[model samples]
Target: MFKLGSKSDADILKSISPSMKVLSSREAKLILRVMDECIHQIEIVSFFPSLLENPEPFTKSLGENLLRTLKEHQELEERHKCLVLDGSHDQTNSQVALSAKAVQDSFRKIVRILRGTAEALRSKETQCAEDIVKMRDGLCELREIVLERLLTSPGEEKQLREMVLEVSQSHAANQVLIDSLEKDLAMAVKDKDEEQLRSTLQQKEKALQEFVGRTQQDAEKQTHSDQKTSEGKRARLQQEASQLNSQINNLIAANREAEVELRKKKYKEETEIENVIQKYDVEMGEKQTELEEMIKMHETDQTELRELEELYDVLDVEYSQIMEERQKAQELKELQEKELEIQSKAATVIQALWRGFCTRKALKSSAKSKKAKKGKGKKKK
Candidate 1:
């Protein structure tokens, strides 16, 4: 067992250099503490072999204690690494380095000892395996011996160790079986954990898929609503178009009626004019005859001339009234034409509105159908 001291690596470094002499006491104390820890670890490593060679009832705890010691040494290594890298560069640095190296060397030595222990464990395992096999074979032999003794002086046989060894072998085999069962149980537990995780993941994925499907369904429903809205709009537009068509037909019929009425009035006016012209020509002919007769009787009639002037005044009044009626008819015809033009423009606007609305409805219906199909596909999947 190597013992740590002030005279170990630390004290020597502290005494040799001015830069490190300022804190020799602290370094010496730390060196002693580190050495004591190393010594304790070495004892644990050394004691493990003895315990493995002849296992005590407390061998499990002894092995745990040995591992604890190894962990302590590892912790020391980490701490040393941190401290060394923390700019602790003094003349004491070499001494600290030496002490850390010593600790590392001790760990290597312990590893070597553990390896020997591992070999010893391997030997023990081989012996156990051999013993197990031998015990099994010996059980058969013992059974045969027991039967033989029963056939020949059965009560005289004294081979109790054979029976005990057979029982022990059975126990050992049972222990091996129990160990294997425990291992399998542990593996089964691990597999169950993994399976649980897998099932959870699958459940999450299923939920996600369900959510997506539901979203798709919602989209389809919205599309359907939009389609219905669009269809309703189209229906309204169609109704309006139908109404507009009715109005157009009515306008056309009204226009036709107006035109026919205008033609009839024109024909009546033309007939009236022809009647007036014929009357005027007949009157002129008669007047010329009367005038020729009057000339023949020139000596007799001033009163007759006065009566003719009054008749002429009445004809002039009738002519003025006819001219005013003609002017009114022409104004009415212009107004009817303007009304027809306005109706034509209105009909065109209604037709365009109807077409646009129909197109929108068709697009909406198609989109709805596609969305519904997609929703159905997801359901199938």
Candidate 2:
């Protein structure tokens, strides 16, 4: 098998210059087609052939094909990476190259894991097939012995019938349990309850394992009972039972692996949902705090408005009182002006009366003096 090299496409592409344009669409499509073919080749190599009578050659062939395909895939990825790196001129081109390198690395890792798992499965299946063949041979020999015994005895046939009946009853009981578990699994899936589904699957798997173990134990007991009569028959039966037990164990392992994968997927989804819920809760908490702050601000604004209204009311009353005082002052000034005008008119009238009286007195005095002078002159004559 060709081993994958540690050096990746990123390491190789790092040495390339970053002054060239990206790859053309046609070249990119060709690289994608090569990748598709590589994937197809890997899938083909992983598939088990129907004619697996002898699995060694088939396993070897599968391994060789897988290794060859992996090598080709690695080479194709390297070429694609080179082409991408050669095309990287700008930031976008560089990002595309890096993305391609990452995808190639992840693909290589997946292919390697697939190869390993395929090899392990092949080895396990090959051993199981061999054991099945051995069991079939043993069964055939037992059948011959049974046929010979049946020809002589009839009581043994009754016991075989009873054993078959008991096995059938046990199978039926196991089937019923399996069906119930399947229903529960279906319900859990329908509800999208990952934890419940995982638990149910676990229970189902455990039940199946337990049932297989019980059947194996019963077979061993039966073989032990048969050992008292025939050692060779008991040994053959024990071998057959062991092969069946191995097959059951392999199936259980496969089921467990599938369940584990499902559990991982469910866990991932649950974690994502929880993260989303947590984010929503955080956002809600922030919004609630913001709302509370807004409410508090609104209340503060209301209180300020009330205080301003009260202040405005007090100012309005003071303005009205000042207006009333100004009106009273204007009225008083008008009354004072009227009183001054009345007093000035009265003084002018009194002065005019006094002057008239003085003129009359002067005229009377002049007349009396003229009479006195005329009498004196008559006496003298």
Candidate 3:
């Protein structure tokens, strides 16, 4: 609802919704990731109403959601810290508290903004939003700076300078917080002193009461002990020792009987175990014999298989030779058929030429005979 970065980012924020049904870890995680990327980019400063007359309009619920997202971020950060601190690290593993604390900030301004948004509504909202926006912008810039440093690792001198700047910024922030806390603590000095004094008095009184009770109990016991005699206590102790000796003798007898029983049981168990072992050994021997028989059978089968393979190979070679002979015969038969066809065609051509020659000769003879007959008739006339 805060105009985050782009229209697309805003749409994505709107799209994610909490369900009425209980959400699984996966869904919750997805929602959290989306909120981080989208909400982190929210332009809250520009949306400050008192500051921006034509502010980028946002819903109150949307603003609340923004605060909720920031809270989630803080919680996630705390969890990360816990995980880091409580992780199962080996002896060699260590952390660089100086560099980490120096570079990364505690995000005080953002947290203050969230607190303001939660309780003090409008009066502090503008300032809170401004601070939050500035922090976010600063974070982004810091990320970019780190990214650039990572991309091209500078010389020691340049790196030192950058690191010093970051460290100074964090130190200044921490100093300010310390100063503010000091002021608050100063204001509560009287109450704190009174509370400390009251707590001290109560502790001392309780201790004194416990001491008096112990002393009174001891005094009463001593007075009662004064009335009693040492001889009676000695007699009681002797009686107790006698009873203890009797109990020890009885326990020794019972232990001896138990030991005898345990030995008997152990002997029986050993006998049974031996019998079982012997039975298993017989079965194992029988199985070993069976396995040997199977192995022999397998060897016999292998010999037979080899013989069959040899026979197959011989038959295959003979079959190959027969196929080759058949192929050659078939080729010869095709050649003979071709030769026969060519001879038949040659005979037909020779017969057609001879028949043409004979017909021409007969026609010429008839024509000459007719001409002679015509000449004789004309001479007679």
TM-score: which candidate is best? 3
TM-score of model number 3: 0.33
TM-score of 1: 0.20
**Model 1, global lDDT:** 0.66
Show model 2 residue runs off by greater than 4 Å: 1-288, 367-381
- The local distance difference test score of model 2 is 0.66
Candidate 1: residue 300 Cα off by (Å): 7.2
Q: Please, what are the lDDT tens digits per residue for candidate 3 over residues 127-227?
A: 44556767777766665543333333235436446555655776677778889988999879978899999999999999999999999999999888875
Better of 2 and 3 by lDDT: 2
For candidate 2, lDDT tens digit of each residue in 276-334? 99999999999999999999999999999999999999999999999999999999998
Query: RMSDs, each prediction?
Result: 59.5, 40.0, 21.5
Candidate 1 residue lDDT tens string, 256-305? 99999999999999999999999999999999999999887774456666
Q: Per-candidate TM vs. native?
A: 0.20, 0.24, 0.33
Give the distance in Å from residue 69's predicted Cα in candidate 1 to where it truly belongs.
99
